[model samples]
Target: MPERTHVPVAIIGAGQAGLSVSWYLGRHGIEHLVIEAETPVHAWTDTRWDNFTLVTPNWHCRLPGYSYAGDDPDGFMKRDEVVEWLNGWLDTFNPPLRTHTRVTRLRQGADGGFELTLVSADAEQLLTADDVVIATGGYPLPVIPTFARTLDPAVRQLHSEEYKNADQLPDGAVMVVGTGQSGAQIAEDLHLAGRTVHLAMGKAPRVARFYRGRDCMTWLADMGVYDVGVQEYPGGQAAREKTNHYVTGRDGGRDIDLREFAAQGMHLYGLLEDGRDSRLQFAPTLRESLDSADATYNSICADIDRHIEREGIEAPPATRYEPVWEPDDEPTALDLAAAGVTSIVWAIGYRPDYRWIEASVFDGGGRPMQTRGVTALPGLAFIGLPWMYTWGSGRFHGIDRDAAHIAASIIDRVARGSAGSVVTDGATLATTP
Candidate 1:
């Protein structure tokens, strides 16, 4: 028989999202237990490459109880700095945590609560909680296309999550697919290491590194761009479906546009369509994609200019960006062997995994159907998902707000005795808490 423990709340994951919620719950005098499959901030400590640094500036790290007080607010934090900060925060607050524990299964109990099967070191235990919070993060699994398996056996392929450094790759030209932030940064890293590089262009937006002597992120925050809710912003649903903007934290935080990569001698191509027998097919949308990205960049800068004029803020002279459009001669196909491409890094995005969750909390696309972290289920909630409530919901600086909301909801549910089931009525949640 497994040992059974009951708590008022059970939170899964120990990353930034989970920790933020824990801080809020602690402040609210709620009894909760946090279950982590590995060490705190495992994504940063275990998965990221050795040279990875946060793309967001240090000032953006704003948890509920803890805030970044470092002097270099404009600078980025490296992997080690992030891990160290999380560890220090954990020790200072000391929220009830059980590390090295993984939740194998989660289901509703007979008493309208949650029953979680937790396993650690070959021992299984059952935990019952009045409320359950899933903070497993947005990027649970790397999204790799099926065509990658058709490549030649000699070719080494890896996803961005698996890539470490240039030395870990084969000694030849490298093809990096997907021009998101990871793809751009990895391509630049390989190029600096003296390797021939080819990048596949995607519909990723581009933003300047600095505008009017302020970081683009700082400007976005100041302009309330990050606080824009998904339902409130124009084209919010379509924008949520697209990949993140292309930017880099390297070289003292700089804009990494495709034109910059092409000028740096990196061959650019359209999206990777298919691959078979060492031959790859690309869509003929290279120019279209680059133009779209450039237009997005220009529009953002124009908004900032308007804001500056309206507020009469004294800022440095701004230099407008010039569009760079380089046409690809062969945008349809490429022979991998002839191009000396020995390794391919798929810098594609990630998808959420909800197989372990035995509830109707997800949609057909596996996205949690929640409103500001509160689902139809009175005692169930989610945190740290991209665009969960606002543009910044998944970001470190933005998660605290959602966390507070969910924590308050959980407190209310517990006070109400965690009764009733979750039901939806056409985009409206009817709960009996």
Candidate 2:
């Protein structure tokens, strides 16, 4: 084992959240060390699909005092542009990060602090810090259920995380499971590549790719739909929660409706029961729900536009994309035998995996039990979590605002002599973008 080192703050993950914490710490003259499993923005540089682009607009990619500098404000940022921005930000902040170092274990430490076991490319070491920030974000590992393992030996399976582009797929028809952002994007790419595509639909909400004249996200943020911090006021909490409470959002978050896919011969099916003779079926209400979500989203965006104009903020001109439409019923079980989709892409969202933190820090769902990133354990803190503060709190475009709040809390703890302060109790899972 390598010799241990100490720091005031220890941050895990080198993505946007971790970098934001380092940036804030530097501003406050705090000493910290960041340990990253890979280089900064490795998710974008290495794992992302070749055609992947950010759903978020460029203007919102600002973190705390830093902004993604460029000329196109309304355009969606491509993966390469994001990498460039992250690298430039790294040069400016210079966070003390040890690349290729992975956190193997974390547990309660002596004197009310955290003990971290880490393995680098060359050696292993144990270190302790007064505070720890898990910025690993939500996409730590790709999730595939045991049921997926039951596929025929001839069938293929792959997680969306491992998917880079349609060209990377094996020859044959492709089936995309899960209807979330990744699944939707991948399905589109495969379909565009002239591959037969099948989409497996479940209870997942279908969203639109863009709503009205602007991205659905911008409208949501402007509506304060994600601002759980203001929930202390009357009706405020409900309003924020209502905006993004369901997997399906109003305007389906601007997703290309699956209904449209069906019209184009992209079979979208569902399996109600896994039985020996059970066959795939189509469900029409599901298609209606997907379309309805978009209609609701458009209304919400319009309402938000009115509010923005009323508040005197220069609301950006709404940019709209014509969504593909399909006047058809929902489906169950893909006709892969007929459609020839050789592969299925599951675009479901990610779930946080805290298996490494053997400590009793997470809940039944695997999320840390904290009130705005402050854990029950003394001298231990968490930052860069989804809904850790507000709706936009976890996103790179607006994550810094939330990090600043967490940093303030940390600073207050240090000034108060970390031990005396009472850790906040209660659920603090705010809605994040």
Evaluate all candidate structures by whole-model CA lDDT and list the values in order.
Answer: 0.84, 0.66
- Tens digit per residue, CA lDDT, model 1, 1-433: 9999998899999998998889877865689999999978888867787778788999998777677888889998888898887777777787889999999999999888999999999799999998899989876899889988888988899999998899999899999999888888888788878899988888788888888989988998999998888888789665567677878777678888668768778899998899987899999888888888888888888899888888898998766778664775747888889999999999988888889999998888988888888999879999898888888888887887888778767766655555654333312233455
What TM-score, over all chains together, does every model reach?
0.93, 0.82
On TM-score, the leading prediction is 1
Model 2 accuracy (lDDT, Cα)? 0.66
Give the number of the best model, judged by lDDT.
1
In the order shown, the candidates' Cα RMSDs to the true structure are 4.6, 6.2
Write model 2 residue lDDT over 1-433, tens digit each, in one string: 5687788888898888777877777776778888998888698878777777777667778875568678876567777778888777777767788899899998877667788999987789989888888888754667665455555545566788888887877788787766666776777778878888877655544333455456566666667665646445346433322323122221122355566666777766653233111123445445555555566545555666677677776755654324466544555444444655556565655667888886777777787777667777765667766556565656774477666656666666665754443231121112112
Candidate 1 lands at a TM-score of: 0.93
Superposed Cα deviation of residue 250, candidate 2 (Å) = 20
